[model samples]
Target chain A: MERLGSGGREGARRIGEVLTWDPLVRLTHWSVALLVLLNGAVLEDEGQPHVWVGYAVLGLVAARFLWGLVGPARARFTSFPPSLSAARLHVDEVMHGRERRHESHNPLGALMAYNLWATLLAICATGLMMESVAFFGVEWVEEAHEALFAWLMISVGLHVSGVILESFLSGRNLVRAMVGSFHKRSGGGA
Target chain B: MKLAPFALALAFAASPVIAQEVAQGDKIGTEIGAIASALSERGYEVRKTEREDGKVEVYAVREGRRFEIYVDPETGAVTRVKEKH
Candidate 1:
């Protein structure tokens, strides 16, 4: 135990070791994803179901945002503030074969996280606006809503790709960590 | 964690807005117009009419409730009436 203190970050976690997510964190993350699928692709644009689904998404995001403030260490915003220069440095570190495992999201992942949430809020705002009689059937509002949804889909694709790429590089099953918080450090289980 | 609220949604709207989609083509205009007039006579203020899967779909409102009136193109008979809930 004393040897680990002097050994720095290497002693903090072994390579290929899985980091876990808080249960609330996992709940909010997956719920938002599913709701996005329903509202964005499955449901009709101007209907009660779509409106309610949007509200559900906003609620989940709000829960996640609050969790970010008072949740566990890893889920906290302080653990991974969004920063492009830090992300650039992270890329450099990876390129130089000096990959450093992070307890929270990697810098680039943080940027994506923030972008996704902000985009969702924007979508929610516009969606709520559309529900008003003044904005209902307005061409610009509808177009903006559709365009934002398109952008969100593109960001979602990128977020999934980022997760896959990071998992491949780190040799850790992040989806498992997210779903079950099973951190067994590479011995077995799929 | 329950999508129960969503699943609880039930037909909720469609000719399928849960049933299919409509496309604008001049050929179906007469049938749609006839359906619209019939709906108008029934106290429904017809909003729009289109051809959806070979049926005349007339969207209308009456007493603040919106409805989807599906008319058979061949028979010119009302087949289904759905309300937005």
Candidate 2:
């Protein structure tokens, strides 16, 4: 088995150089991350920037969903359809020391992707509803938005933990992958 | 860190007037209807009200501006008003 992080030694050995993350994938990922952090923690919610950031996050989610249909091989939703059996198998492999590193995303990662997108959509929808004339001052809508935000925070925690765990197990820096670069054993393991 | 407790205490401090405004035994001091009436008197169209953090968090609109007014349950005073951005 090729050692994970062997890609760090570019001169001594070149394994497989693949562009796993497309520009849009990397862009949307970081953009959403920054916007969420800004709105959720750094920025004041009463400021105009907070609303604009929410709108930007909504736009990014919409674009990402659309890209999942027409984007590159790795970006397409077909690349990692959510499957319980597949996730179970991945879990089993992890337990048995037979888990193979995925070229794009593992089963659990795909589930998290779908979950984050859906949760964000819910948060944005409620947020937008709260701003509408009819729904303005509606308690349930605000409560729902708040509840979804809490879920989003939980999802974020899971995502970070999953990334860290996968990186350790696969020996590949997943963070580097999301930023448009990753190392793989060329023509060796599919 | 020391200021945190002070701030928390300040936030929850109830004035003497507030204690006299509502009964001591009753939680959520003033009735929701009374809170709504008080908000309406101030030009707010009360949309919804919930008991939160020992206060009545009223969601209301006034002259088309939405506001989240946290009212003291006992005194029915608008402790804080957060307008939508």
Q: Return the interface RMSD of the candidates, in order shown, one decimal each.
A: 4.2, 1.7
**Complex DockQ, candidate 2:** 0.40
Evaluated on chain B only, what are the TM-scores of all the candidate structures, in order? 0.61, 0.60
Using DockQ as the measure, the top candidate is 2
Instruction: Score each candidate by Cα lDDT.
Output: 0.72, 0.75
Question: For residues A50-163, could you state the per-residue lDDT of candidate 2 as single tens digits?
Answer: 778899999999899898888776788998999999999998998888898675679999999999999998988997887876798776888899899999999999999999
Question: lDDT by residue for model 1 over A9-56, one digit each (tens)?
Answer: 311223245644666787888999999999878998767999999999
> By lDDT, who's the top model here?
2
Computed on C-alpha atoms, the DockQ of candidate 1 is 0.07
Per-model clash counts, in order, read: 4, 0
Off by over 4 Å in 2: A1-19, A181-190, B1-35, B38-44, B49-58, B62-85
Indicate the docking level reached by candidate 2: acceptable
Model 1, global lDDT: 0.72
lDDT of 1 by residue, B1-85 (tens): 4776665564463222332222222222246666666556556667666678887777666666656667778766666777765
Instruction: For candidate 2, give the lDDT of residue A147.
Output: 92
